[model samples]
Target: MTSVVITGKRYLTKPEEAEKFGPFERTYLAEGDSWMDSSAWNQGSLPEFLVRGFNRRGRSRLIVNISTSGHTLTKIVDMMNDELVWWLNQGTYDALLFSAGGNDFIDAARDAPPGQGLLFDMRGKPMPANGYDCVNPAALQRLVDYLNVNFAAIYQAVRSSGKNAATPIYLNAYDTPQARDAPAIRDLAGPWLYTAYTKNGIDPALWDQLTAGIFKDILHTITAWADGRSGVHVVPTSDLLDKAVPGSTGDSKDWVNEIHPNKSGWKKQVEAWLPLLS
Candidate 1:
């Protein structure tokens, strides 16, 4: 495995404020969720696994993992500041792995009461349920536009960074989630799409596709932007984790929460991504 630090930074507001995950910095920096991971999963990530497999034979890699739960593109771009740029200029890094943007729309999909937040489809007509109003499809469109530019901006910033020039960059495209949760509270990463559908008057049968469709749409937009960048690679894992294997929870082995993968799920991700890094 290559030497690196994983530090997390995020932007949550409109003017977007960049906040460091911690006080210290390392060589390998990480951002994003369950896949990138949280305390609950308590497993390892692709980057960690990669190092254990390869870097163990020699000097250990310096890693900085600063991922936050429910990270959005807005939060990521805001984190690019003089501090990180200075660190990049000073350090020697082999690669940077990134996963983001799902939380953007995942945040939008919930509580869109048919007559409320996102009440209509693109046609400017009221949605079938919960209520009615102008179509909020524009919400997704606007997000697409924002991410298209920002994703590239983040990539370019990494490429132009001091010691990071020519460094390989890896991005993960998560497998589509079950897209349905038991509808928890706001701000918590549980179920929102299921609540949206049940509340929006959408047909129950269409719920799964509806949720998956939004995820796919945003993911496609993200992939298109990353398709042929110089050293950037997007790893896809939807098929591995996007199945229905409910237990005490109505989810799969691949997932622990709404968007994060469990240990088995991360292993699957590593399997797909190791070859790319090698």
Candidate 2:
């Protein structure tokens, strides 16, 4: 891949303030669990797989990543209609990638725990600091409804806006982290947000329960709604993390923070995307 450039409406908060896995700059849609603090996927960090694409000895491919942190559905549509049109006019990119929805889910999770801290291990059992509400089905359902509607709109916008419908658009699924060792992360405001997966005090079994089955449902739901478009590819992280084999404690593939990928995990992310790119 060649140099990447993202163009879109920018957000007002600091990038570091996001709890999702992304490293996105201004306006990004949070779709899944891993998208919670996407600092690693921002313009600067460039997920390792994209780097590999850059290094390949083939026709040059440019990644034009136009995203911002904390972008909502209405904001995203406005940006695509306005700022993104400007970027396309500038003649950039060999391929385009889009992500969003995680923030909405995060918002949903918030409603579930309304005014309470998420203080349990991934297993949903009480932890040292365990005393908060967690994600209830009702909140998740609302977010899912929102994602289905907006995702289609986003796809239609990109496809109809003179960009090639066949332009290898890649979307991603969430990596549901094992929940056993999670802690409640309180924001600068006095609210109890979900905890980040820390390495210091993780219970392996709890992680297994947290990650097991939940992500599959998320992926399946999205894919069902997506209708298997040729231009879209959904990277399956549940399979990727299978190398860690949730139930087994001997897996060395665990990341330092029980949530974010380590070097090996990053490699797995790249591997998942490679097939789609080709």
TM-score for each model: 0.72, 0.60
Estimate, for each residue in 1-278, the C-alpha lDDT of model 1 and write its tens digit.
24433343322121122123222223455555545643333444655654554454443445556566556777767766734454466566667767777776665655554645543432343344422222366676776888788788887887888678887777877776654563222434566555565565565555555656676776687678767788877777657764545322443566655555655776677777656655
Point out where model 1 deviates above 4 Å.
1-27, 41-62, 111-137, 182-188, 246-251
lDDT of 2 by residue, 198-246 (tens): 3123343343443344355467755654576656666665566533333
Model 2 earns a TM-score of 0.60
**Which 10 consecutive residues of model 2 have the lowest summed lDDT?**
185-194
Clash numbers, per candidate: 27, 34
- The residue-level lDDT of candidate 1 at 197 comes to 54
Count backbone clashes in candidate 2.
34
